[model samples]
Target: MIRFGPAGNGNSFYEAGHKSSLEIPEYLADVGLNAYEYQCGRGVNVKGEFCRQLAAKAREYKIFLSLHAPYFINLGTSDPKVMESSLRHIAKSLAAAKDMEATRIVVHPGSVGKNSRSEALARAERLLAQTAAELMPSFPGISLCLETMGKINQLGTLDEVIGLCKLDKCFMPTIDFGHLHARDLGAIKGRDEFEEVLDRIASSLGAEVVQNLHVHFSAIEFARGGEIRHRTFAEREYGPDFEPLAAIIARDRLTPVIISESAGAQTEDALAMKELVQRYQTGEGGRDV
Candidate 1:
């Protein structure tokens, strides 16, 4: 199925009088979503009991759980101290996912600081290879999902992510269409652009990978440096509209897990995408662009 969810509990979740993360699954199920990405952008400090309880609740509601690893992890770093810290962060993330019975952990590949893009990518590749060798065997069921980044100087371009994923079978690409659009200065104008992206990934990673891809989508504000912030679907000024993507997924029968990263309306935006997909499937959606 094409799963739709928010990257984390959005403002609506809290405003609705739901406080605990444990209630997320039921809330999502109630709103017609089937996935949830727990945020660990700061650190992976969730207790074992909490993880287990959340997992149980998710299972009860049939939610597909995922975790976003700490944003501080920088696999592209050349410094031994930073690299070691990054490795530790990922190991902790994997442990948390295992405890929660989450199948995937999304990661940012890190930025290209003073080094050239190629050098940064190479460093990231080596570090990730080490990660796969040392940590992956313990978490056999979980996939390390590398995300496409928004900044122009980041190490997560579409090609870079695909190349990194090629390093190990357990690696998957988290195709953030918003990031791609922002990084490319709002290049994704319509269905044709989205189709090209899907086709590129399928050609490089095989049809199976593309069919069941991990996706992050939201409208974004961008500048020359890329990705100012994620915007809600109601922000009609944003260029990367979800309707074209929904139509593409419907027409191709892709079963990606789409997570919304809208600033505060992530849950609402995710539901909107899900509704679009349903409409497209029933031939009631707007004309494909």
Candidate 2:
């Protein structure tokens, strides 16, 4: 279906006279978008009944729903107390996802902290496996998406997330292209570069998952540390250009759910990417959305 949508209540969304997150799906459907990502990046603060009604509204509008879990979860922690806290945080997010009937819950796979990268990753792996074993039975329908972090010190690399996905049946890779690009110092450019990523995922996980990917796209500013911030579409010169990825998506006829993470213009940028894909598929050139 090649779904294109925004990360949260987009910049334009607030201007359109909306206050509640639950009001997003109908607006998205009205604008030809078929997907919605509700952000609980701080934490899941709502009641189960609230999420249930939100899920029902999304289903009524045929919008695919996904949730971004809390930002504080760091399963790579060396401290036993912090690890226990992380477990509780993730479990709470999973419970919310089950109540909301969300297809996926995006999570940052944790950081290296004071430990060596290898040690942190190994810790993360064990924690994730334990999490799956404990929670999968209760929340079987939702997938835990380990995100590709933009920072170098963080545990989430493309390979790291892919490895984590292999740790459990409940996990999947959340392919944050902006984070990948930033981590590689703005590496992605043309079709070959973009296809190399898709190929790696396909080779590792299988083609079906690759074809129906959950991808994030945005132009990012990066330093030696990686991922300074996400930029708007108006900053065209700064990019791992969407056109190349759009071309590949169209050519391969993949059914990816692409979420835009532009600082404020996420919905506008997502619509722009959807337009770019349409232009490529139709073989027309140079039209903006």
Candidate 3:
């Protein structure tokens, strides 16, 4: 089954009177979501006991779990100190994900910095390969998901992410559609564009990878530099609606984990996406849900 949920607990989660992250699994289950991506973007400070508790709760609630690693991890960094820190961060993240029984952990490939895109990508590729060599055997159950970044200066375009995924069978691409849309200055207007993305991934990585994809979707605002901010679905002015993608997903019978990162209203937006996908699955494809 295709999974739909928020990247983290949204405002309504708190408004519903839940005070702890441990409560999120039950809360998500109650709200009709079947997946959750735990945020560790700042740092991996979660205790093993807490992760064990969360894991149990998630299993009981039938919620699939994923983790987002630190935002500061820079695999392309020239500095030895920075590269060491990046490896440590990935190690800690994998450890935490293992404790949580998370199937995958998402990572950013880092910025281009002063180097040309090719040079930066090469550096990131080598470092990621090295990191995988050291870490993959220890965390056999967890997949490392490299994300498509939002900024043009970043090392994670769709092609870049796909290349990284090819470095290891255990690696996967976290295709963030909103990031692609923003980075291209709203190039993904509808189904044709979305289908092109899917086609490219399928052609490059084969059917299994495309069918069981890891995805991030959101409405976003952008400037020339790329993603300005994530916007709620209610913000109708944002480009790249989810309906087109939902239709394709249903049509292809793909079972991807689609996480919403729509500002503070992610849960509601995720629910909307779920409904949209269901409608398409039921053969009710149209502009209207």
- Tens digit of lDDT per residue, candidate 2, span 184-209? 99888777778888999999988988
lDDT by residue for model 3 (18-68), tens: 899999999999989999999999999899999999999999999999999
Clashing pairs in 3: none
lDDT minimum window of 10 residues, candidate 2: 280-289
**Which candidate number has the best lDDT?**
1
Better of 1 and 2 by TM-score: 1
- Residue lDDT tens for model 1, 1-289: 8899999999999999999999999999998899999999999989989999999999999999999999999989888998999999999999999989999999999989899889999999999999989999999989999999999999999999999999999999999999999999999998999999899899998999999999999999999999999898889899698888889889989999999999899999999999999999999998854
Q: Using Cα atoms with residue i matched to residue i, what is each candidate's TM-score against the true structure? A: 0.99, 0.97, 0.98
**What TM-score does candidate 2 get on C-alpha atoms?**
0.97
Among all windows of 10 consecutive residues in model 3, the one with the lowest summed lDDT is 280-289
Give residue 160's lDDT in candidate 1 (0 to 100): 94
lDDT of 2: 0.87
Candidate order, TM-score descending: 1, 3, 2
Candidate 1 Cα lDDT to native: 0.94
